[model samples]
Target: MTTVRLPLFPLNSVLFPGLVLPLNVFEERYRAMMRELLKTPEGEPRRFAVVAIRDGHEVASTAPGMPDPTAVPELGPTAGFGADPARAFHGVGCVADAATIRERSGGAFEVLATGTRRVRLLSVDATGPFLTAELELLPEEPGDGSGALSEGVLRAFRQYQKRLAGARERTLSPGTDLPDEPSVVSYLVAAAMMLDIPTKQRLLQAPDTASRLRDELRLLRSETAIIRHLPSLPAAELTRGPTSMN
Candidate 1:
């Protein structure tokens, strides 16, 4: 596996390969990161690792360079996040390269990052302008049952969607129309789900495509069962998507 020292941005969400993470970057450290990223000879990559924050607030108000501290708005809750920032990051995270940038009127800017591959974070260096990490590529384990596995995952996923629509008592997108490759399908569905960090991280760290598919099937089955029994569930609660805040 290859290793590279890359900038790390911690978020409250988990990203899977093939997913797109849209972010609003206002923190000073991340702003400096963007400046350094665009300065390579041919232009350094707009790539970085988006790790899930374990315990700390998304941004510490008192971090260096702060103008003034304000009351942090209450986020709904912190689920699946760990307790220690040092060892809190999920070991496996997606490598994302900025696909688009929209500078806002304020100092904050919007960025679209497309997830590529999983990387294992070896160590983190926080002394830089932004968090930097020694990341090694985490390759998926190739398995033989891709054909059967993909079909199974797709079937279960479809049924889950249908059941979800029933629970919502409304029409929803009936299809994800995912790719045929098992690994891609696995990541796509994992991205589509509204899972917490630990679950997403576990799926990302699944040893092989088949294992990931199986785990997804179980999750779909369990969720579908709940949908079937419940009187109703809010569409917002049951529905899942790829886009998330950073």
Candidate 2:
């Protein structure tokens, strides 16, 4: 595996390739990382890996701790996620390169980054305060081009978009016009905007375009069905902020 050291950001949101994510770099370690990157020659990639934090929060809480459990269950199921946070994440993750970084009114930076490729998270270090990792590049498949999206698939996506639009209108009229080229980027942005962070992460980790599209089509259809069946469902239920990727 090819390994590179990366400065990491732990956030509640997930980022996807071809999508934009704005970061407020207030922390001292991250600001230092950004300054180091900015000084580098243009076109030199200042790449980093994104990973979901298994531990609850970086800053430990001082609130009164809860008492230990009274008793372990007699026949508990095999240990799951909570059993071992350390072993939770697969080696897989995305490698993103900075597109833009601007200093905000405050001392922090307002940065925009776009995903360029996928990387495997080989190991991580919290040697300092912020997270850092060692990652390996994940090679793209042979047919990574947009050609796999058949005419039938495109038509289905168009239909899905239409339904999605209708659903949006019923709630608050979000203005996400369907793109002319329903390209892979388009699908990625759509999935990024429409789904939650965990769901979007799943989409990013999907092996190929076909599987990602299938999952998005399924989600869009499901949301449309929900709107159709429960027309009375609160519009608030359907409201989600636009993805930074857009």
Candidate 3:
């Protein structure tokens, strides 16, 4: 049960390991986070934990003249630690490695990162410029029959992609080749599907590779069937990948 402390970034979408995450960081709190991360010497991994905000608690930009959206509420002196700030975020998240953090003209940052590994949130601290948390690094386990499951998921995923293309009248991946590894297949399918946040979060929290692939298999078949019956889909509905936010 190895644990590490890192800055936290809560987004409206779920992040799966091995997926690219591009962010438009414009908020003051996140600008400060970028500055802190920049202090790290170059050539080292600049990392942060990205957790999905729970339903009804979406992070939004503060309106002009309004209080800072990232500010922690001032609890009374008698307020106990039992008041969990982590409640606003899902328990499972992915650690992102920032490969490029470019400071913009207005002190904001443009970050290009990739999800490296999964983690479990232990606790969150908000009494700082930005949120930080203690995370327990989760291991990638290839569970029972994951190899077989991967084959099934890949087949279903191809069908799913074809159905999606037919519904939207555009090829989803063009000529992009799918991977063969079980764990990679699971994460790729999880990220590529147009599922809801809770479903993707559940896939991220699955106990092992086989479990994630199993869920993806079910989802691909179900979603493909639904898509096959649909007359057409809106272009917006065909959008995939992480939701880029500022």
Once model 1 is optimally superposed onto the true structure by TM-score, how far is the C-alpha of residue 139 displaced, in angstroms? 1.1
Global lDDT of each candidate: 0.70, 0.54, 0.80
Give model 2 RMSD, 1 decimal. Answer: 8.8
TM-score of each: 0.80, 0.66, 0.86
Estimate the Cα RMSD of every predicted model relative to the unseen true structure.
Answer: 5.9, 8.8, 4.2
lDDT of 2 at 117: 70
Clashes within 3 Å, all models in order = 1, 2, 0
Best by TM-score: 3
lDDT of 2 by residue, 1-246 (tens): 667888765444555565556665654556666777688687898777665434343221212222113212221211122343224454456667888888777656777787667777776665553457777777654234444443334555444444555545443223444343434543454543456656766766777665666666667567556645543433333334332210
Candidate 3 residue spans exceeding 4 A from truth: 61-83, 167-176, 233-243
Model 1's lDDT to the true fold? Answer: 0.70
Give the alpha carbon lDDT tens digit for every residue of 157-184 in model 1.
7777667666444434445445888889
Error of 2 at 112 (Å): 1.4
Q: Which ten residues in a row have the lowest lDDT in candidate 2?
A: 70-79
Q: What lDDT score goes with residue 82 in model 1?
A: 25
Model 3, 113-158: lDDT tens digits are 9999999999888778777999999999999999999989988876
